[model samples]
Target: MADLELTGAEVLGPEGLHRDGLSFRDGVIVAANGGRRVDLSGYLVLPGIVDLHGDGFERHLAPRRGAMKQLDEGLVAAEAELAANGITTAVLAQFISWEGGLRGFDFAAQVFEAIRDTAPGLVTDLRAQLRFETHLLDFYNELPALLREWHVSYVVFNDHLPHERLAAGRQPRRLVGQALKAGRSPEAHYALMQALHAQNGEVPGALKRLCMELKAAGIRMGSHDDHSAAARADWRTRGVDVAEFPETMAAAEAAHAAGDAVIMGAPNVVRGGSHNGNLSALDLISMGMCDALASDYHYPSPRRAALMLVASGVLDLPAAWRLVSAGPAAVLGLHDRGELTPGQRADLVVLDAETKRVAATFVAGRTSYLSGAIASRFIG
Candidate 1:
């Protein structure tokens, strides 16, 4: 039996964009023919967007200041947004910090169980990315357990203490609390913050220990927002393989030079700036410094950013396409995805280039989303 053929779809291959047909069967692509005569003249298609860094689920987890959202329900809503944005393989960032109050390890643990149990049935293929705050030594206990989980694809080390406090004799909690606008019980928040700050305010010897342990257990390591070349060198020494959003161009250039993958936030590109005032992603792209781009917070940013890059002439469409697809997949060592070639996992997304909108999304050769009339008809 022949697989379903999508012909006349605007397909992006190694060559360039062309009218094409792709055949899907048994959850993988068997053939792709840009010259075929099937009728898909209205839609554009590309490899499914691969997001390497994103952590906004904290928004859904705590939607209304103090309100806790149900994990299963939140995940379902997140998937709809991912598919609508052309993300078929999503590495949902889950920050497992040493902090004790809401959005801390305890809360993360529950979400982990829910993610492991529910991800297989979700609309988009889901992977867990544990953003580890290296300064939090107390999280050592969780590392062994978390490394055992099958869905954990990434483990990033971020040390946020410098930004949280000026000088603290009390505990790391004193300044950290201001970042949140009163979420849970004050006492509970106080205790958790104090306990966390006490342990994480120094260089993380425990993290170095856990890194080796987790590496031995087959987990990949990443470094987040490294501010200098020396920091990148330090992460390299710790066996950290991926550099996510390095704050300086020199640091990112060093990572790329040293054979480490350099990641940037797509939002940074689309907005023409960094929310945290870090190195600009467009600047990195233009200098040939960055390797991959993720929807760090907003899911739609990756697709929109890629199109904008091509339109602005920062990169040709093919090269720009790699930032959202092949680049991140290669960075993560996920060869089975990020390409539309035969024998690869049959994940693909259809978009309307005119409107820069997702028209349809597929995962493993099956439809994950079919946009409604408004989306289908939209032309930008």
Candidate 2:
């Protein structure tokens, strides 16, 4: 909580980058300039990234098949990775689905319990997000209690089954592999899929009622991979205001038209297009459709993607950086830390200006990750 002055860096300010540096104390950003100075002449200071949705932590939790028996260790590893990548606040997107393995309800219970227990010692602000598969109708009655127990504030509705193939009476190509991972035979899995698909008629009503209950509980909700304007409208009617990775331009436009935030994958922006041939994030950015960029499946991509946007002349550094920081924070209703302003939380990242690489990350005025060079400056 001691006062610290970060001098000799180009600090990102509301007006844009400033030559004068910043000062902070007591786990909050402060306006006062005089303090114990730490020179960082060749660095660029920006607000720390806030990832709204990311599943990359799944690898740490289960590196190989059934390897992660220790949830605490996996979460610690995940926190380190997030901090190293300049993330200050991260939403761990855990699935509540029938796909089983790491995505099942049982696994989610363990993760939620571990997160609640381990969060106190972590520097990074970790939060849970439930990726609720819409077809898991039976869980509808149980989800409210789970959310309450887990203290989850975010939930996203997803329908990931290959409905087209299933409706055509053709088994999906990866059925066996998926079933094996779920610890069930292909026949059993197929039967489960068929049974779920049969309830597609009842899913809409159940989802509507469930969404209303979640909204009543003050939980933020969103829909995933919306494919059309009509799909967006349907979700909007259910009070699912945020649209996560809308698959088509029409869907994104619809979300924007409704004043809902549109989230796209940071990897999509870095790769210049969706790997699955959906909408292009950069294209959406240029058109002003994408409101925020998430880490998605890769932790490093948020930083890389924002810098890439700057390099591609799509946006200036401050504007592009907002997509990863301020934008996502606002979408998730976190009014505290996304901007480099006085009285805000002192969550920030210092990057080597020449290489655009993260030199240090700070969360709530505490060092979470620091390279040797940056550490030496403070040490000496």
Candidate 3:
């Protein structure tokens, strides 16, 4: 709306802090220099955080354990919440699984397309991520068309078939009971998982080829929960530039060795460890091994974890900010935002620096949320 300008705040950058004024016209930053001036006396201006993976919004889409809501309103609420948390660029990690009922790709596709159409009216920019399960070949068979037209951010390869592990009495199937209750009989699920594993041998090769198709169309792709150096190397060879929640120290180091950005979830950092016994992000960051932090299931976790890292002396503020903002924007290949650089996108967060709390957020130069009005919120 306004050609926004603000001054008298600590502008975070890779090099360090600077007392500079920043100005934005339309949605692009027009200036960033100490000489420029406006009026944000006590605010701490930081690049808006970028979330690479989060399914918290899926709660709104499927609330109350089994209840469903209108996708339009649900997504709008998700946008408001994301903006409230100061996430300027959000990747909607929509699941594409073999399950063939509600919450499947067909239903998610319509809703995700609706999000793209309605993004202009929402509080933040919305990007899509096809969370492709290795066992989801049935759903994936139709992916070529969706990937072509959708603003697909990244493709995540997952293989969460605890069915085989569960049936052998090695673990419980509680994790995927929802899918099981949706008429995917345990036997059938096991059969599907077994079939998919066999099919996976063929699919990774096909998916590797599909990566070329996606790249030709400008889509980025990545692998999820890679467990070893060899696994990371394999995906790297397939043109995957991101390693999402790599499970082993060797895998994370390998991903880094191969020049793939390593992304971990903030909830993993904040909760003292990972949910799935993976490498602890705190340890990774201690070793300077982590690149970006996604909101994952808890949107506020990223924002909170960034400050917490500073508070705990794990990272000075600028470095912490990079993990959430510039780091993600760079890894995601969006050179348009994530820094207070001139000509960058004007997605920004204004914080009460003394209090270390977000005061307001602007997405594409628009006032999307006022932290003074939402400081008490615990969710995004």
Candidate 4:
């Protein structure tokens, strides 16, 4: 890699933003100023985003109901989008759920394998995270082996079944659509839901055992949409430390109190509230309960959300931006690449100071996305 010194920009450092030039060589930041200088007077150079959880790549992988057959190409295209949005390290959240078709085990395996195969050639650091449905007791025994095979180190447990409705013997909303999507008849799907709900008593034991096994394997575990303190406590007891999108303030507070990493959807912050009337991420952030903001289902939201927080006076630039950068890196247990400090990976994004739009992105000192007037600055 070429040695370069980016000068004349408001470079974000470990403490805050400064006018000091940033230099990097051989894919890592350096303390010495030995590279060719590039003037970036009107830009704000910041740490590249570390996205802990996001499923926005699903559309790129399967644009129109299996429209894209080559999954590797889809991944490459997804990486382009991620780079455009200023993400350097992204965890693509793929589901292994009872829902078949796009979210089935088979589809998830394909996505994971494609990511593993395509990542080496891509500039963006792409990783796979398995969103496992907790009610899939049949797969619990083999899930650890499956995760190893898929090369997935992060796992989030979720249960989307409407247990109250099932216990009431009432059909869930959109049962027929869900059944068709799963390639099962409405009657069969309904029966399946009932059976899954009936075994709820046995789930805790199975889940605890699974969590123990996964913990022993050194895999990171998290719970999704946690709704109560008790629920958070139970997961923590099972060695699940990360809390992804807790649905209530109590749940978030519980996670915070326990020193667990609390991840909120970046879209929730950008929108000022949850789309489904759950807990407000902004509220949690204001209370200092949220540790990081993830892209969730929108790649651009992480950047927009952090900037919005600063614009709204919720936090200063460094504090708000940390939710997307260093905070997420910590959640993922990554010791490098979150800050522009020497010895760290040279992962960064340059944004037009006026519009706050991404002008360029770099990962490992390699240009991943460079456009607009910034391209000329580099070329000239």
> Which residue pairs in model 2 clash with each other?
none
| Overall local distance difference test of candidate 3 | 0.79
| Cα RMSD to the true fold for all candidates | 3.9, 0.9, 4.0, 0.9
Residues 115-148, candidate 4, lDDT per residue (tens digit)? 8888999999999999998898999888898889
Question: Positional deviation of 3 in candidate 3, in angstroms?
Answer: 1.9
Tens-digit per-residue lDDT, 84-127, candidate 1:
88898888787666444454776777777767877888858778
- What CA RMSD would candidate 4 show? 0.9
Q: How close is every model to the real structure, measured as TM-score?
A: 0.88, 0.98, 0.89, 0.98
Which parts of model 2 are misplaced by more than 4 Å?
Answer: none
Candidate 2 lDDT, tens digit per residue, 99-122? 998888899999998888888899
lDDT of each: 0.77, 0.93, 0.79, 0.93
The 10-residue segment of model 2 with minimum total lDDT is 26-35
Clashing pairs in 1: 20-34, 354-380, 355-380
lDDT of 4 at 167: 91
Instruction: Give lDDT for model 4.
Output: 0.93
Error of 3 at 68 (Å): 3.7
**Superior by TM-score: candidate 2 or candidate 3:** 2
